[model samples]
Target: MTSPILRDPGNSGFVVELEKFSGPLDLLLHLIKEDEVDITDLPIAKIAVQFLSVINELGLNQAADYLEMAARLLRIKAQMLLPRRLGDDEWEDPRAELVRRLLEYQQIRELVEWLGHAADARAERFGRGYEAPPPDAPPAPLQIDLNDLLAAAERVIALMPDPNLHHRVVPRPLDVEGATARILALLAERETFGWRDAVGGGPQATLVDVLSTFIALLELAKRSVLTLSQPEPFGPMVITRGISREAA
Candidate 1:
């Protein structure tokens, strides 16, 4: 029978004509069945030669698995040729391992075939097809009364944690007016200084204080009370007395 042509993945241009056998074992099994010989008593010499010939005909680019199987067959053939020692009747057959593998593969293949047929037979048998409800059909009536629903709602509400427990009231640290007085006091002490010096406390400064100081700085900049400058991007903002402050 003509084999199927498979495109080689390594070389897109190369095409491989693969036989019906799925793998090296499948090919070996096919050869054994064709010869009509018992698996336990495998003709190692003839089988090895046939296996090698088939591999060569397939070409040098055959899979590594096939090459390995070829090598195994050759080794078995060599083992079979070794002469038996006199009075050594307890000699183990080299073909024993290969025979076991073939037998197992054959059983699995048969089981798979049986399963395929069973699946086909199952598909032929049918069940009552699904019948969708009519679109105009009225929805089912509620099983619970209004009193039962209210009781369930009350139970759910009781399980919820009290909102008042999470509520927090923090006093404001400083307002914009307080921030402006602090900046003015710092300016009076020094003609020019960084905004951090005006804000005070560095990293220890609270978020409320920082926000209030920033708002005060923007208001001062707007009124021209102080000029804000950063020599480099993201550098510390330099505060210099504006004309309004110098005039004062």
Candidate 2:
């Protein structure tokens, strides 16, 4: 589905069907395009007015995420309204910070656009049956033994020894209690969501969360709470909750 947040307001002069605004940067970009103004010397009053108009239209729920930026714009507008102090040769422009932030946003926006372009190119290639270029491999193998691998593994384990030597641990703190709850909630709503989506953009969890979630998910798999399948190695595992029973 297309993100409403990225849609352009119509070309009609008044009473635009405002798409959902994601954040302050989105609002600022909208105002910039609307006014056709340079970022450096943006008319604070005009931009602020446009911003307020959009906010009023957005109402409370949609506006909550954007309040910080709206407040910032107001602060800048306030500074612009105030008279400069006496004997100040170089006055700091109220628009400077806003300009800086907008520039950064623009850079990121360009990056996203570039990535989208690349993705489209990749899609085209796939559509045309493009095979990936072969990976370069070592000219010769540097052979090592099973004992050497085991000894290296032991050394690493010794470096960061777990204090509790003998404990059949119930579960780690980063256990998936909350994540599992969230997963269940999502499944209840969506029926089936991508396993990758279940993880969200992750903040991802720490190693503990990843490990415990994997273990917990494995347990859930055993209990037939969910089904996990890897149709393709190195691809995302497909998960459909409340199906199939197999040891994780």
Candidate 3:
């Protein structure tokens, strides 16, 4: 699909081309796909910042729907920052509702695209006849709305197999302790490593493993066992042995 071009408000001569999105939800989905992160496990803080950047760049602040979605992202980001209370093992994720909406929107968008393609193909196969309808023919009744499409999407999704079922069969909790030990072992072999290295096994590593390793890195940094640095926002994190590790 061709991207749309927008004139820069700051500079009269500057023009920017951005991917066309149907709405705020479509924009969010595009950003998520660019990051290549799972919809179920979103990095809310990062995604929120990216979302705001896109809105500001396009001068969409005046658009009420876009502004509303921006506010929603900020709220979710703030909720995720709050520390969990002790003994509260069932803390619901702040991103849950947003994720659900995004999933539903995605399914409906796909269905619509499929339907459009089918209609085009049918049109090609059957030539349009020049017969006019009766003068008193009734207009076609409205058959579908947002609610109907959402319900149909839900039914389709319910019939599909769960993607995470295999993980449920052999559930392994996030192994922070093991992750820490592995990081230490890696440091023993080298002076520095990147986030992917700490996580290990490259693409084979599961999301749970990546998250647990990240937590382990934070713990190590807190104890002065390692130093973590990122050159810029949304950049790769680098790990190096700390002064304490050197002394030890």
lDDT tens readout by residue for model 2, 153-173: 774565453586555344556
lDDT agreement with native, every candidate: 0.77, 0.68, 0.81
For model 3, the superposed segments whose C-alpha errors exceed 4 Å read 1-19, 131-248
User: Candidate 3 residues 1-248, lDDT tens each?
Assistant: 21111323463432233358778899999999999999999999888888887876776655778778988998998999899998898999889999999999999999999999999998788566858766987877756677767776875566455696754432777889999999999989888988879999775676678788999999999998889998644446899988775567
Q: What is the lDDT of residue 3 in candidate 3?
A: 14
Residues 142-194 of candidate 1: C-alpha lDDT, one tens digit per residue: 56677767776885576455687684344875588988999998888887999
On the 0 to 100 scale, the lDDT of residue 66 in model 2 is 66
Superposed Cα deviation of residue 12, candidate 2 (Å): 27
Model 1 regions lying over 4 Å from their true place? 1-19, 126-248
Worst 10 residues of 3 by lDDT: 1-10
Task: Arrange candidates by lDDT, descending.
Answer: 3, 1, 2
Q: Which stretches of candidate 2 lie over 4 Å from their true place?
A: 1-20, 60-62, 85-87, 127-248
Give the per-residue Cα lDDT of candidate 1 at 5. Answer: 20
TM-score, candidate 1, is 0.44
Q: Please report, as a residue range, the 10-residue window in candidate 2 with the lowest summed lDDT.
A: 3-12
* TM-score for all models, in order of appearance: 0.44, 0.41, 0.45
**Which is better, 1 or 2, measured by TM-score?**
1
TM-score-based ranking, best first? 3, 1, 2
